[model samples]
Target: MINKIDKLKDPLVQEARELSSSKKRIFKNKIQLRGLEQLMWAKYAGLKIESIFISEDQNVDDYSGFSSPTYQTSNGILKKITETNYLIPCVGVAEATPNNDDFDDFVLLLDDVKDHGNIGTIIRTGKAYGINDFITTNDDFDPYIPKTIDASRGTAFKVNFKRYKTPQSAVAFLKEKGYQIVATSPYGKSLQSTVELDKKPIALVIGNESVGVCNEVLEAADHIVQIPMHTGVESLNVGVATGISIYELRLKEVLTMLAEKIISSLGRKVSVTSKLIRRAFDIKLKEISEFSGDQIIFLMVLKRKSQMNEEQIGEQFGYFGDRLEKFISPLYENKLIKKEYEEIEITNAGEDLLAKLWPIHEKTENILLEGLTAEERKNLKSYLEKIQQNCIKIMKYEV
Candidate 1:
């Protein structure tokens, strides 16, 4: 008669069982990466591997960093590892534990946000807006899931996130120490209301899209804020609303550097309330009409396109002879802007220069743009749009 337990008798399984029972171990800790489980007993966890295992024998060492384990299995171990005739060989025993501390800055707490996409997009938005820390209710979608990581587009590694069995406790801790707790809700006040943000510290909270913030946490929050919606649209996607909110807070409160965004959003036209630094740049030029730098008077146009031809420049500033050219030329030559085919671009040099004299640029750009490389922004926006679609896809059912 065939043995009922023959499969379990493979020597490889025997080895794993034996090691699992051992006690001696060593580890490293008491530092920033202060709470890792695998490292807690690195000696045993590190060396207890029975043998390298693989489903099928093939080359996997193209990038050895992701390769090493796939290449070192004995023929006996291979058969035993593959319980089924079809092999299933990849295995490692690192305990999944959230022992990371770098998640303190602007941590996002997701309270029962059920949709996986919403969770993913919120994470992407947090990363975009220079927020690198997050905490989720115990039931929030799994951050370690491959789909969630894919949604983050590598941002998962940059940010620190942990799952909390509860967010109410986190809220209480934050409120006690003066962190502003703002919640998202249909019933919240207008979006443009002034937020008194402290440069010292702050936290913005988001709730489940379906039911809104829990009453318990809602009562616990310092304030409940909302994003104003158009008459037709019901509400913003949790992720989109979060991105816009964070954008406003970071650009306005975090730093005053990006005056252009405020200008750009006010309809491709420039505004008159000149940034303090720009006023300083052309302080003397205000005397003449051609150089009439009435920053306040012209709310519609701010900087004349630097790349404009003499005619275009003349249209904005009355064409003047060599004297005026000498004056306007400096604005062009400094690389604050460029004129080509009558178009202009504010260069990095220009943006930095604007940032120095004004404490605004660093805070505005750093926090609003967050740590997003240019490419990441495109991917994030695209991903957010995709998430919005999936949400809408699901949302259509409710409507």
Candidate 2:
């Protein structure tokens, strides 16, 4: 329900205005979000909204879906609550950004970086490169400040961050977790692009605007790297430099992952490719059905053979014992499949499910083989069949 508030003296309005102070925000465990875009992004990140205050002229429908109490107020009250002279469609009070301890393969470390704008920009850039985890020195730093959130374009909630009392402590933690610490310094002998980065996790540290990386972090880093610049230019902004470094490092990581996937042994390559194909199929299958790719594949096998015993099915799919039972239970419970004595068969419902799912299978295959010619695809299938037969023969010999 939307309430009408005309006075700045209202308790909720005063509370909203008080959230502008960092100290009060921390004490109340709430953060102020200004404008529609920020509120939308906050909701997308699953942040809980306590209340919303909007100008009387703004549509109440836009704020309705938040499931929070919204109040329609005068334009002056809206400006006062958000501390902005310009017109803001709405202002939201949301739960403080939650901490995320799950670190990705790459982490960005902020060492005494005081500029909220730069921190936010780094976060935006890091998100672009699939780096969502960050570590920073815990002092007076607040990543959710209004300027930081604005600079991040509302991505501050999408990322995860952890804080350490000092940069040295953060570096030590990363090292203990088997991460290779790469710190940026203009004086470093190694160029950013040329630095050796393998498949190991990395912690890339960006430092303060005025002084660069702290001495302790620089000395502790596994690799001190620098971005090359024109002779007259000393350095770039910390945010810009971070963007360039993240791009180069992420590109290298992708190339490395792809190279390993393709250039490994034949068996490994086949295994990885099979996993990738299943992952792609699962993503597409989710849009149309609740079943997983493997479950659908099981249904397809039953359709092909009409019926098969447990032993026969095991031979084809390599599932047995509890694993087999766990896989089959869902289908049987859902009435998609039925059992007759020792034989298993697909029900009419299963057939219908397959009819709906076959197009997704074909589409996923086409997407995977997008650039390959028909002849190449045929040859590829033939090669895989031969490899499968050889593997079966070896398994039979071992048995």
Q: Encode model 2's per-residue lDDT on 155-262: one tens digit a residue.
A: 888887787888878888888888888888988879888887766788889889999999998888888888999999987999999999898877766676676756
> How much is the lDDT of residue 242 in candidate 2?
93
lDDT of 1 by residue, 262-304 (tens): 6556333323423543464345333321332322222113232
TM-score (all chains, Cα) for each model: 0.46, 0.64
Worst 10 residues of 1 by lDDT: 24-33
Task: List residue ranges in candidate 2 displaced over 4 A.
Answer: 6-11, 26-29, 83-89, 255-399
lDDT of 1: 0.52
- What stretches of model 1 exceed 4 Å from their correct place? 1-58, 71-105, 139-141, 198-200, 255-399
RMSD of 2: 16.0
Q: Worst ten-residue run, lDDT, model 2? A: 253-262
lDDT of each: 0.52, 0.86
Each candidate's clash count = 6, 0
lDDT, residue 233, model 2:
96
